[model samples]
Target chain A: MDERERINRLRWRCTRRAMLEMDLLLGEFLERIFPTLGPAQADAFIILADMEDLELWPLINGSRECTDSVQAEVVALLRDVRVK
Target chain B: MSNSSIPVRKFDAVIVGAGGSGLRAAIQLSEGGLKTAVLSKVFPTRSHTVAAQGGVSASLGNSEEDHWHWHMYDTVKGSDWLGDQDAIEYMCRMAPEVVVELEHFGMPFDRTDEGKIYQRPFGGHMSNFGEKPVRRACAAADRTGHAMLHALYQRNVRANTQFFVEWMALDLIRDESGQVLGVIALEMETGEVVAFHAKATIFATGGAGRIYYSSTNAFINTGDGLGMAARAGIALEDMEFWQFHPTGVAGAGVLITEGVRGEGGILRNSDNERFMERYAPNAKDLASRDVVSRAMVTEINEGRGCGPNKDFVLLDITHLDPATIMKRLPGIREISIQFAGIDPIQAPIPVVPTCHYQMGGIPTNYKGQVVAADGVPVKGFYAAGEVACASVHGANRLGTNSLLDLLVFGKSSGDSVIEDLATGKVAHQDLPENFAERTLARLHRLNTQTGGSDVNETRLELQRTMQKHCGVFRFKDMLAEGVAKIVEIEKAVARTEIKDKSQVWNTARVEALELDNLIEVAKATLVSAEARKESRGAHVRDDAPDTAENPNGRDDANWHKHTLWQREGSSLSYKPVTMTPLTVETIALKTRSY
Candidate 1:
């Protein structure tokens, strides 16, 4: 698979609890993951496993990064974890 | 301070100074049905014991045929015949069991393919009359002490032992007749003094390496227990002999564990010559710490040192295979990368000697019981680890013997204290008013003084003076001068004022108190160093070059005693060394080589 497709596949498997463990904001994990993988990939993988939602396709095909409303909800979730 | 008004916190045993020994002792005591409380100035995980990166010595008979007798002989010889042979034998015999116990506690020691713990060769560890090097040091991938400490802490947590973190013990609480009780501790967060009463107390507070400005010691290691014991009229044994590890990262003085040399790292100067071959032709790069440290300084003094400043030489490990370096020395790699911004795989590490471990502390017997100045056991008070001199390490500790000493004595002290507590005849005493008043006055003085100097600046001056004068090599004139300078610094310390007087999380008060401890220990160290004239172990005398030049003729007859330093008001006094209960034949002085 291409780098973006591989990242999307990894993000679909991500969980909120995993995101907290990696100490990353939720949308940031998706943004960094969707691009070519680097140091942030390991962090995103850990965080994705922690969230309650475990489905793959919605995250894979979702255009949330392009939409303002969906992006705000994802950012809000991360902000909550950051405060914790 | 009142008998009725004084608050009491009870434990079956209370362990002061939660280093390797304290943590290990707490685990044993709690498991044996004693309610134990471990008290430390830092988090238990950050104890100076964690700074030890080499390994613990034990004769596991790995890589070669080895026995406890061989280990004992090497220890006695490494100690330069100053060690009490009886205590040395006890430790050697117990070393195997201690390592096994640590393994049982889940310390991740490096293992051989046969699934047994791996042993490494350390400096001065030899076999068959120093004929061949032996594998005696049981290690865990260059972070043995770190792994051992983590294991002990985990075990302590499993046992549910109570811990009072960030509480500094000011003084030993004793009665009018001087029977030991507990301690007066200041809560770091609230600055409140609380009394922790126990049937028995153990001081595992590590060493006073910070007395020297540049040392391999952690910042928090300020000789707290040693100072407290000395101030309370207990004599510090062999305070003169401070071990300077040879291969510290030069300018920073961070320790590059002896394991580096064990793994074939070489020491070289600007000449690119292996200089140790001239000093110790046989052991070469792996000579005893005192010999190697002195040699390094001498090379620098002779203008053979590396770099522009010429203060340090190179510890080249780049020749070692990358896989071995990564697997066996992951922690060393991390420290070098984080602190010095260098990778050992590509370049040589800058290295020099730093004041490492104290060979002296509150004088104790082999049982780890704190003996008074009169040679009587102080009831309800025990000591272990680097703070207590069971005389196992003697004038100089061996490379891996320190961790062995901590674990063996720590467990023994726990068993002894628990046995003492089982009698249930311990008397509770009221905390004296003067004790609290003295501590309060010191804190008040720090808060109220208008300031003759900044505490940090004075501390830096003290460290620099110690590093220059009383370090690796010493002379009577230099030590005498160092003593005078330290005394002046002590006066300056008294006049020093706290800049941050706010009560909430006030570290300034802690630093001020720690300075008092440091100064007291520093005085004891200088005084003891001045008294010892002969070249023995870590305490080297330049003017009195050898025992042949000394007034005392015989080595075994004269120099076998411990140097005891007493704090008499503002003055210092000394007593003869104790060399008793000798079982094995004393090893006579020979030319010590690599």
Candidate 2:
């Protein structure tokens, strides 16, 4: 898929959260941070979308420490959005 | 008007909605050696019955001394005298038998020290005739409905009941003589239209809580059966009476079962006081759901609410032992931590009243046959569960009694069908010249339309309008305006368009059709609620307050009858609530207090 097509698909996936709280948190992230993304950051955001809420939630809420370097930047952004 | 166009499947009985009630009914027909087909919009177990967290009430006397008479009295008083006495007596009398039967079907219920089914205290269940709380709700921990639905489904499978998963019933097909033949259903996978011709059609469709924006119902609860029956020129009875569960998680609308309170949890306000002590001095937190919900809402409105917005209360279970919390209400703790972001073992869960169950729908007798009026029965048609008002839960339903209602009525309906068919009197009725005409036209409109109303937007408007105007507290002007606004919204819903024209798993198409059903329920609720000026059970109006002289504001002399709403011209009529019980004297009406 083209880069633009991939980014748009990832953005749509953000809207489809299992939890309503996650919907708002990810939705805010999609609107504010997703557009001004570098290729690496966009790819990092892509992987986070596929993770289940049980895993993805702790990373965003900072309940569990993020060990993976790839997800570190996106997870930090999600945490920022949640606190905001 | 060719009859050979759409595919047709035949069965001795077709049951719509494979929830607790439908599965119970299906097991009976299948075990009776009748060919049965059960259709559901989702998988059988995933049906909303799995979402029921509390126990089913039965006078098992497993935990303490109890009797069916006490159970009957509690239910009658719980319903605010709106419940038909005969139906309530039948349900209460049959409760113990059905619960034991469910146990025999391999339902793993929580047991006492002596290995009897464990019973929990629930709202509106009393001992010695409302003198004290009783342990009558037989539970499998807090997930009684999940255990019950799985056990019933397993039994149906053993009996070889054929199931049509992901199929939605579009409309009830009736013959020229007004006998229900079967249903026109849509196969959700392929978008294929098929008619399930049957000797009997059972609508076990669950609640219509989706009519409100904030609800405890799953997305599949669109009130399909009620809508189909209404469109076929049938009246929906007691549509105004809706039960707002006392403790849905604040802001999330996920249900926090009353089972927690039944297990000795408390409701605290901002003042950190048990406010229910003032509202229902005797029953306290274990009052009927309507009473508890109204108390919570009153607390919020009176500025005693707990949350920052002062819009919610706190359900405190921190006083309970951790082991008891885990053993009795594990699902509640999970729901609280996951949805409300609180651990009930340590902290209180934020809760508010949310639209939970419908106490009314397509009218039926205790035998489960859909009735045109009081005594006029519709042949070959039956309904149970939340979809059919059998008038057992007339104005309000007690906690745990809903599950009991399904077992008692669902089994009885199935047995009645067996008896009816055994006489060799019921056969395949000739289909009207074009039974599928309306369904085909509806689909054609969706496919061929250009720039019609958006499905989601219109549905949101309907929910918001219902929530705003016809909320927990109803106002005279607001309800009148609500009727007009909902009538306007119905026009837009009738024009709801879908973008997805694909014949493959088109959920958009399914959603638009569900909107059609949701609008009917919304209209019926608003129209019936507006006409019923008196406050009775769940349909409480601000204008109708309980004064010193007139307790509960129940205008039995005037509004004692059921509000029947017809979809044809939005017309409404009333039928009297049956007062006489079988072989028992009438219980004198009095102030309905906890």
Candidate 3:
């Protein structure tokens, strides 16, 4: 494989693992703290979680190089966890 | 003490460290219905015990033919006859039970298809008095210490032992009668000093590897408990003999677990020739740590080393199956990648010698009672772990003996303390003024000193000096010069100051305190290294070329006694080693070979 292709593969591996762990931790936290949030809020949380995972997936997995939007999204997700 | 002025806490027993020994002791103490508290400077998982990559020694039912007697013989021989026979015998007899107990506690030891704990052959472990090598090391792949510590911590959580994390013990509080009453500790988060009173105190603080800069120790292995004990007038036993692991990542000083070699990784020079064959023909890659380390250094000195700089040899594991490497050495690969920035699967990882473990510390009996400076038993004061030497590992420690020492003695120390607590009455005394004053003086000096040198720079200099002079090979003149340089560094450390002065989350202050401990322990090591005249085990003397002295005289007799150093106001006093209770018949001295 080309260097770029190799790097992309390695990045994908990293991002996939990071996103998976982050989602698991957040899901566990939400379940523990607020298990009875309204359906719309819970739906919003799920969509946001998916979006956050997608953003983290690229950077951490190294499929796509890190970008300001991706970094901001990850930071927001982390901050949300802290606030909760 | 008023509640406003004194931050008072109480426990049935307070364990001063959170490494293997301390965690083991806490598990026992709490399980036995005592309220135990483990005070540590870092998270229990981050302790240096996690750095131990080899296995714990035990003669389990793995081979069905293994016995504890063979294990004891290997231990005695490994220690080069300086190990106390009584302690060695006690440890050996208890090894099987300890191993079984760890398995019961879910240690995750590698198992055979027959559901038996898998055992591996480590250096110097033999059968029938050096006839053939034996599989005595009970391991969990290569990360045995990691597995063992994780198991102990898990079991400890189940026992509900209170963990006082990130709190550094500043001083042991003793009454006017010299009985250890409690300790005063500073919380790392707030810099708040609190006085903790307990019925008994156990120092399970690990080794002083950070005293030398280029060591395989974690940043936290500062010998704090040993320094505190020494300052409290405790005589550190065999303070001179430090073990340098033969295979560490060159320049970085990260340990490449002996398990690699135990699993068939060979050491080779730049010419791709097996080098250990020249030094230890029979043992080859499995010679004792002291011999292997010296051989590696000699190769480098003779310009047979690998790389353009000719600094290190190659630890070749590329020939091993990928599946085997992934399963047994996951952590090793991760570390090599993180620190050395190399992929071990394709390249030979560069390796060298690094300061690993201390073979000396607070003097204790088999029961883990702390023997005072004057040979009197200190009441309510106990020691286990690397901080306390029950003399199991005398002149040199074998590859797997450290974990064994922690488990065997950790259990014994707890049991002995429980016995004392059951029978003896609690003697209460007021905290000494001098204790607080001395600790405050140190804090003040570090906090206020605005000039001189950075603590980090001075610490780095100390490590460089030790790795250069007192490492692998040594001579009297070189040792003397090393000691003199260390003394000068100690002075520089005294004047050394920290840059960050904030009381909140002040890691700099903690580093300064740790550096102070490192300096005191380093002084002890240098002084003791210079006092010993003959080469034996890890403490080799290049000036005294021959191991033999006085041709008509008995061999190993002059080197029979252990070297003891006592800190005496900027100088050290030497004393004779105790050699009694010789058990299982003393083996004759022979040339130590693989």
Best by lDDT: 2
Q: Over the stretch A2-72, how does candidate 3's per-residue lDDT look in tens digits?
A: 44333222222222121123323343335443355555544444443444333443443344653455444
Query: Of models 2 and 3, which has the larger DockQ?
Result: 2
lDDT of 1 by residue, B386-492 (tens): 88888877767888999999999999888888777677645455556554556566667777888367888888888887876788888678889988898899888
Segments of candidate 2 deviating more than 4 angstroms: A1-84, B1-3, B246-251, B256-352
- Residue by residue across A19-73, what tens digits does model 2's lDDT show? 3345456666887888887878877887887664556876865668876776898
Q: Enumerate the chain B TM-scores of all models.
A: 0.86, 0.89, 0.87
Provide the lDDT at A6 for model 2.
Answer: 49
How would the candidate models be sorted by lDDT, starting from the highest? 2, 3, 1
- Name model 1 segments beyond 4 Å from true: A1-84, B1-7, B256-292, B299-351, B546-557, B569-594
Q: What DockQ does each listed candidate score?
A: 0.03, 0.07, 0.04
Q: lDDT of each prediction vs. the true structure?
A: 0.74, 0.85, 0.74
Against the hidden true structure, what lDDT does model 2 obtain? Answer: 0.85
B414-497 per-residue lDDT for model 2 (tens digits)? 988998899865778878789888888888888878879999899999987887678787889989999999989998998888
iRMSD, per candidate, in listed order: 17.8, 7.5, 16.8
Q: What is the interface RMSD of candidate 2, in Å?
A: 7.5
